[model samples]
Target chain A: MASACWGLPDAFCQFPAMDGKSLLLMRRTIDGTFRDIVRSWSGAIDAATAPLQIALNALERAFTSTPWIVVLALVLAIVWAGSRSWRIVAGTAVAMLAIGWFGLWRDTMVTLAMVSVCTAMAVVIGLPIGIAAARSDRMQRVINPVLDVMQTLPSFVYLIPVVVIFGIGKVPGMIAVVIYAVPPMIRLTNLGIRLVDAQVLEAAEAFGSSGRQKLWNVQLPLALPALMTGVNQTIMMALSMVVVASMVGVGGLGKNVLQAINNQFFTLGFLNGFALVAIAIIFDRTSQAFGQRLQQYRGAAHD
Target chain B: MTDQSVPTLEDEDEVATRPGLEIRGLYKIFGPSPSRWIGAVKAGMTKTDLNRRHGHVLGLTDISLSIPPGRITVIMGLSGSGKSTLIRHINGLIAPTAGEILFDGTDVCRMSAAELRGFRRSRTAMVFQKFALLPHRTVLENTRYGLDIRGVPRAEAERAARRWIARVGLGGYENSYPSQLSGGMQQRVGLARALATDAEILLMDEAFSALDPLIRLDMQRILLELQEELHRTIVFITHDLDEALRLGDRIAILRDGRLEQVGTGQDIVLRPANDYIAAFVHEVNRARVIRLSAVATPLAETEEAPRLALPDRLVLEEAAREMLAAGAERALVVGPRRRPLGIVRIGDLLAGMVRPSGRPPTDQAPTGPRGKP
Candidate 1:
């Protein structure tokens, strides 16, 4: 292909070939300085990141610690309340029981825990950044290019650094999932806030709503549908990371899927894949239902 | 048809001036180097020239108006005329590049962020053209929002909100959301929310512009009825000439971000300041826009015989109807307490009903000062 070159590109090929390594000379020079900066603030950084471990543990326990019957009942009740439809509740109950009967209950819960934690971390970090971008054009100018790069880059290309930095573990895997999935959260949140009607914001400002009040009462509430869509996308993206995440030692249905892929075990792959779908259905419906409920109230006023 | 009843709801009395919201020397320029060109703008540079030479858009230039309280002071213009910009300045929504806005003697532009918030929460409330009701909140909750944000107790805010909801005729739809209401009803909710705030000043930025023409008129009547009891200092913004003439106690017209003319409806219709203002007011039917007092002739010794009595504040349309109904050629235009001030001839009012094509038809300029000497 290079030889052919559409018949005339010798000069183009002969043009100065920039060494990729030389391009990063500044980074190489600053690498030690970056380490020093990290070392100097390691304690504060650790303290800040420590809550993340607790969040992970909390999600794990919330999904896994309770008795199976208790967990099943609570989950069914929530599903029932959200849908207010007996048929959907019954279908969800049967689906959950079928996965349990297949001896994949523990694996399913572990996957759920990781996805839950990743989404939580994504929302926590991404929302404020999204809001900062929405509020200030300068911030948007800084973030938009970075967000565009994050979206366009293949998610796997960033994994080498994640594994190198944090080493192979659930933490590193969670970080990777977060990096891959968090962009949507930030993007949609920024869009939602930006999309708030100009007149509404004017009214809020005219009435003397404080920045904090406007954020919570007007901007956040109005942006909820968009935010919820972001959350929904984040969850789906996180779930997609299950098999890739298992490569770093996080145990879940992803591990089983990975094993099936290695050995080409069709039945094992299909069952686990079906189980993932069942779980996805549950989470998707609930969040979408909640968003719809919010919209209904807005509609109900004029109804 | 929408304005079903003739709004004979007023007694002939002039509103005493209450200088509450005053914008003095207020100017706004859009773009990076506005300060560099503002001097040029003030030195007779055109808005188009400023944009061409320096890429700066002059929004409002040397706008000064003392908006009287207990009356609607409307800022009116065609699109790109900076009427919206001027209204926002009153509430500090848009900070002026130059000059000051004094709300009840306090400068709004100089207020600290916290002070501004407090002022916004307590002192002024605005209605929007698109019925800026919070979609998440119910009609009742939306009404309670201004008070709620100011940290009024839930029960107390709800009560005040409930009273206003009923007042705006949204009694049973308290729990209903804004999206469910029609455009007119949604604006009613907007009105209720502002009224519930109990703010001293009501800034309505083209508040009725979104409604159907009939609905808009209905909203105007409702606002007029409410203003009779609650005379909040309303600063209304509109591009519609008729709405401004109907609602504004004192009208301030803006063109190309500069104040073109400021006067009563009678003043504007009878005497437009320049060609731009003259063209703007030329199409307005004087009989419908002006009152009997504006066109009434002083009773001469020979013409002292009164055939019928009408309030001086009555529009010539109503006065004409009354005079014709009473089978009289002319009617006594009385001020307060039925005291005769002047007499209005039916022929003059009939002539007024047809707006002149390009210029005011009559040489007398009965209502406002004539443009020509």
Candidate 2:
């Protein structure tokens, strides 16, 4: 009997696969092309992103230099404005005070600044793309797979590309955080817009609403709840990236946690981790409350 | 052309003066390439056959109708019969795969995008079955939506919206959101919104169908009362025969996306065009729909006309009631200016109320027309 049972060569009996050498060559080619592009375009890219860096620096400086009491009061006021709940405001105040008690207030503020900047940038970039996807099936088809990859790929994999392109700094770290965080914003916005009542849209069109008018007047208003959820999710994701972002020379609670880890300071690591959790809770509660407030009209009792 | 069968304005001069919508040879095939299948459809491919062969759903086929200006033309059909699709075509919300929608000698189908926008903004407004009011907008704001789209000044738009809101009997609910109101009230807001636009054409797609029966009757009365004053060319769509009979100055019946018949309520109830239409009208309350003129006998020169007179436009049910109340066995059916057009007896009125037992005569049949004694 022949060794090849299916009447083929023995080589065909094994699964056809690329050898390691060919795989390595393909990877090298991709890496080399990216490196060349970064070498040629680094200065131009830095200039383009200078405004983002400036904004981040300004926010960080403002948070750090401001009196601790003033900053605490401001945070409480914002929580109050968003939630209109004394309980949430008191909880946020207690968390902030606890962080300050641990001597990590400044680091907490720095992380907050970074998360805020990343979130704002993600929203600004994601909203229009999401709206485009909602309006066109072809655009949606193209965007959905990319969104899936961005969401499912390990966060560290894209950080390498970010480091290569922008070098180690706050801007590159912010870029990495946005890349890891923006899928929810884009996905929810697209879903929200697509889910608007078709009959309502028909009424809008029947009334001769121009496309721009419909988007501004009908779509955005109806999609506000989902968009707010997207904002909340982006904030949470950006906060989670703080520890990862510290590897790029970011100075924040994440940096302290990294140092603690290296030195085996369990207490210090836990303290910094608690501070991060505090910030996340405050943001999550405030944004959720604000989102609910925006949709108050939907809850009115029928007469 | 079957155009003669369509009811015209009583005064021919008014027909010439007002530019009504004339939909000619309209065919809408819903598919990836709708225009490509228009030839096969026009060649008399049945809706089902076309769908089975080409995976193209027929929305409307060969719909030719002349909607008289300043009157209600109700397009009646069951669900999936393309009544909604046909109404959408009137406002250019849905473009026909093949046809011309003529208004004021301008082909609406051929209008540029900007021109169509202008036409919809300035000439037409619509009410929906589900009352698609913006949930976030208050009654006042929702009512002003159309005017806002038209770029009307905010103050002026609100003023007009307020007037119509009050006109629709939603006087004190201006600040309430749509979710805060009942369905009937929300539909009132929808009506007010359309009315506030001051558009000449009002397209109401099952505007009252979602309401309870009593509320529906109330809405129909309100619509008729408003129509008496406004006289906008209203195109109403409904699956309810009773509603169609109540509202339509001329009724058009549709089946499987095809135009089955077009005429007045009396024409449809007394003389359906085919068995399909006859079956549709079979269970309708005929006495409430058929007017006395349809069943009245021509006044003979040798006989005396009855002293008790009723308007020829009155339905048999109402005429019978009036005759019974007056204890009269007979009445003269009067036309405009109390002119005696015919005579109707109580026996004939009672007989007219009952559905014909045998095969209902179609328009094309040679037998003498029933209900025209």
Candidate 3:
């Protein structure tokens, strides 16, 4: 293959490429090493992930077993509380009713549970990393390229490693979703903190605020809008990853969509796809409105 | 221009008892390796030469000034003259390349990180030109920021903050966020915040420079009013000469990161240290700054006492107003306890008020009249 590509010239056009045999050998070594590591760590990993499995199961069960009307009321209440807008609440109600009418409510509920858990986990993990990156240039330099790779790499590629470690369950699906969705949360948080007014930070320092005080009292509060945006993006990315995650034996609306695609059931694919979109819009709007509400002080009348 | 009489603390025994800041031979070179160029900067290198020859910017060079306790010491300079840098050094916000900031006989430059924080929290508070209040916090919360950082109980902090808020005339605006207030009101909050800390040293870096002329005057009045009772050892930084003259008990003028002159406002206005400072003070309204005692005529052997007597501390403008109101041709310039120190006529006051041309007044006592001290 190398010779074929270099056929035009002996020097300039001949790229310094590793031959196919070496490439294949390198791939086998990496694959074998990863396999050995996963096999050795599988039991410990399962034990570590047990709590995650239990929480995800409980959330899914709660969503699915609860009466549909109660779930609708809960969601509507959350939307209203976040937005304080009657219009958004009405829109959410109509969307939830439409999903129920299509008989995809149970699947939608499962996806919601998975997305909520994934977003919570991402925020819990991403915020500190983001803050560390904001505080130190060295940390940011180390994390930036890794986050780039996490965001740009194909979602299915990482799912392979996750499944190899977790053995194809909701936990593996969740790990994959979090890995795919956490970059925005981390990046936005770092950017937000870095962009806080230097004058304000200097004032914080001038007031003799301890490191923890400065972070909690100034950086975190000021960075709340960007943090909220990160959460919103994490949720949307997690939702988008659901169908791909379903390929690894995870069940939800994503599984239904995957089945529809495999069986070439166009109506089923459209139905599940629209259900996902409706969920995305509702989550996006509510979270964005909540973020804006948090920053209402910014819009107060300026003298 | 040759006479540079920097005030010494040895003479002021009363002021020495209170904690005052003494900056000794401070040099700050801003670059990756500031220490590398400090020797050159201290020896003779100019700010431009340092920045041009080496990659380092000379922030401050060989600045040594004594801030008397219970008085306002204004560090006045144009932008990039290191006035702001000098102020930050007082609180150890920016460490010096070399030299010591002596506060209560302790070297602030040598303090550990925790020690510096403790010093800043307990001994000093700062007001910024741009009013760096937390947008998320209300006026009361912002005012209590320093106390909060020191872990003061919320109720106690709020009580102190409320008193200062009302003191700075932001009484009714405690609950309003910073964005909701005007620049003047926001700076009042900044002042209140610093004041609430009750720190002996108030570091105000151009605190009123951002306000409109009227509001700046208003803030200055409030500060002066407060200082009458508070007597904080304030180190205010300002580019405005008039503001410096009005507020500073002792003013230190900076030019290109070096001290041009350190004296009372009358000293600078009457006898500038160099041509640079002469040019700086040339635009100042002499009547407003120069006092009657600086230009008063001594009481001669055969001279009779004047009918009208005015306090020697009165500025030329105020004396002129007083003399003109009484229609007196001359007045005795009396010192403390009503001792007749000198006499000054309307002609002398008029001559003193007029701006000098081309050359600065010589180091000799101001030329118009010699007071019998």
Q: What is the interface RMSD of each candidate, in Å?
A: 2.0, 0.8, 0.8
Which residue window of length 10 is worst by lDDT in model 1 chain B? B4-13
In the range A1-303, model 3's lDDT, one tens digit per residue, is 448755665555666698999999999999999999999988999899999889899999999999999999999999999999999999999999999999999999999999888889999999999999999999999999999999889998888888888998999999999898899999999999999999999998998988999899999999998999999999999999988999997799999999999999999999999999999999999999999999999999695
* i-RMS of candidate 1: 2.0
Tell me what fraction of the real C-alpha contacts between chains A and B each candidate also makes: 0.86, 0.86, 0.86
Tens digits of per-residue lDDT, candidate 3, B139-231, equal 999999999999899999999999999999888999999999999999999999999998999999999999999999999999988986677
lDDT string, candidate 1, B43-76, tens digits: 7888788788788888999888878767788888
**What does DockQ give for each predicted structure?**
0.60, 0.72, 0.80
Best by lDDT: 3
Candidate 2 per-residue lDDT, tens place, A82-147, comes to 999889999998999999998998999899889988899899988998999999999999999999
TM-scores for all predictions? 0.86, 0.90, 0.91
DockQ of 3: 0.80
Model 1, span A1-303: residue lDDT tens: 467665666766666656778768866777667666667876875676677767777777778887778888988998877767677788789989999999888889889889888888899988999999999999999999998888788777777666655556678789989988888999899999999988888788887788898899899999999999999998898988866888887788999999999999999999999999998898788778867776776545433
Compared with the true structure, what per-residue lDDT tens digits does model 2 show for residues B128-151? 999999999999999999999999
